[model samples]
Target: MSNKDEAITIVSNFLEASMAPDPELAATYMAADVRITFTGGRAMASPQAITDFNSGRYAWVKKALGPFDWTEHEDHTVVYSNGTLYGEWPDGRPFAGNRYLDRFEVRNGRITRMDVWNDSAEWLLTPELNQES
Candidate 1:
């Protein structure tokens, strides 16, 4: 496979892993030296770290990421996605949504870096919007 194809496959597999209770597949996509920055000023190196933090949100809130529209731009591939995250929260609150911008940096065939930014605040305020979400 080409570098672009590898990147897409890695990302797709990672996404599948993310939905599972365990994040093993997600970690496979990352290089050991990978660095990631979450929107909340949380920065981590290992893919496991990324999963550890995100798992908290996923524990009770289900996230359905989808409709990923991809564009092959120069040497990079960008995917624009829209999805729904709907599940009951651990605290018994209905926490069921988040919109996001997920960016990946692929080198060779591994993801060396990733940055995630999302409209978490919007979901925090209104769970109902998730229908039209």
Candidate 2:
């Protein structure tokens, strides 16, 4: 497979592992010194840190993955995966379509860096908008 294909596969498998709520499995894709940045400018050093953070944010959460858009570069492959989230909130209400964007830097079949963005911060800023439907 090409670098682009490898990047996509690595990202796809990582997402699948994450949806399984298996941070250990997902971390396998990451580089030893992987850098992660979450929504709201929260920075972390590893994939496991992201999982730990999310556990405190929601009662239970899972990603509804969409598609992967890959960009091949000389140094690394950049993969952008866009998706929505669906799960029970801490208050016991279900929510979906919490749009998310994840950018991964893949090198030699491993993700060296990742950056995440989502709509949750906007919802947090607008407290009245988080109501149950």
lDDT of 1 at 133: 31
How close to the true structure is residue 70 of candidate 2, measured as C-alpha lDDT? 86
How big is the positional error of residue 85 in model 1, measured in Å on the Cα after superposition?
2.4
Count clashes in each candidate, considering only residues at least 3 apart in sequence or on different chains. 1, 0
Error of 1 at 31 (Å): 1.0
Off by over 4 Å in 2: 127-132
Candidate 1 pairs with clashing backbones: 85-96
**Candidate 2 lowest-lDDT run of ten:** 124-133
Q: Tens digits of per-residue lDDT for model 1 on 1-133?
A: 8655667777767767766645677777777888788878789766677667665654454457765555665666654445755665444555544567677776666677777776655555665655533
lDDT of each: 0.65, 0.85
Residue range 18-98, candidate 2, lDDT tens digits: 777788999999888888888877898777788888888877888888989988889999999999887876778787778
Considering every candidate listed, which one attains the maximal TM-score? Answer: 2
